[model samples]
Target: MAHVDSIRKDMVILEKSEFANLRTENEKMKIELDQVKQQLVNETYRIRADSKLAINLERSRVRVTDMFTDQEKQLMETTTEFTRKDTQTKSIISETSNKIDTEIAYLKTLMESNVLETVCNLAASVFTCLQ
Candidate 1:
């Protein structure tokens, strides 16, 4: 009967040790689960921020494209206007040059005619005075 009592006491101590080990394992599992949950939350936040940044970048690209298109159109208009003005200026210069040439030719002919008439009159007066 004394031996049976000793065996029973040993069994109680073994059972208590097993229960403490199980409690420690449960605490470790809880800590691991909390860490996993925090990692999931951080990953989700990063994904959301990346998505927003992508959307903003796309919007900015569209705006820049629109501005570039508008600038291209304005440049084309300005170039066309300058070409038209250049053509108009060239035409006016050509007409003015033609008029100036014509005026110079007329003045040269008039001067030659006047010099010939004066020489002819001087010769006739000299002949009359000698007679």
Candidate 2:
């Protein structure tokens, strides 16, 4: 009977040790689960922030593109206006040049006619005086 009781006591001690080890493993598993949950929360926050930033970046890009498009349109309009003005100025200059040429030719004819009339009158007076 004494030997049987000692064997029973040894069995009891082994059971307690096994129970303690199981409890320690359970605690470790719980801690690992908590860390995983925290990491998931942090990743979710980062994803949300990145999504907001991406939206803002897209908006800014659109605004800048619109501005560039407007500038391109304005530049095209300015170029067209400059070309029209240049054409008008060239036409005016050509018309003014034609007018100046006409006036110069008329003045030259008038001076030549006056000189010939004066020479003829002098010749007639000399002929009459000789007679």
Candidate 3:
């Protein structure tokens, strides 16, 4: 009977020790789980912030693209207007040049006829003196 009581006391001690170990392990696991939860929260916040920044950058890019498109359109219109004006100026210059050429041709013909008449008159005067 005494031996049986001693065995029962040893079993109780072993069971208490096992319970203490389990409690310690449970506490460590709880601490680890808390750390994991904190990390998840931090990661979520970082992801949300990154998404917001990406959205803002995309909006800015679109706005800048629109502005560039508008500027390009305006530049094209201005270039077209200048090209039309240049063509008109060239036409005016061409007309003026043609008129000047016509006047120059007429003057050249008149000068040639006058020179021929003067030469004939001089010849006639020389012949008269010789006779």
Q: Specify the highest-lDDT model's number.
A: 3
For residue 39, give model 1's deviation from the true position in Å.
70
Q: Give the number of colliding residue pairs in candidate 3.
A: 0
TM-score of each: 0.47, 0.46, 0.42
> Cα deviation of 26 in candidate 1 (Å)?
99
lDDT of 1 by residue, 53-86 (tens): 6556656777677656665565566556556655
> Clashing residue pairs, candidate 3?
none
Q: Per-residue alpha-carbon lDDT of model 3 for 1-131, expressed as tens digits?
A: 35544755665576567556755665675576566556655655665566556556666777677756665565566556556655665675566556656755765575566557656755776687689
Least accurate 10 contiguous residues by lDDT in model 3: 1-10
Model 1 ranges with Cα > 4 A deviation:
1-62
2 or 3: which has the higher lDDT? 3
Candidate 1 residue 78 C-alpha distance from true site, Å: 1.0
Task: Output the number of the TM-score-best candidate.
Answer: 1
Angstrom error of the Cα, residue 28, model 1: value is 99
Supply candidate 1's per-residue lDDT for 65.
Answer: 75
Q: Rank by TM-score, descending?
A: 1, 2, 3
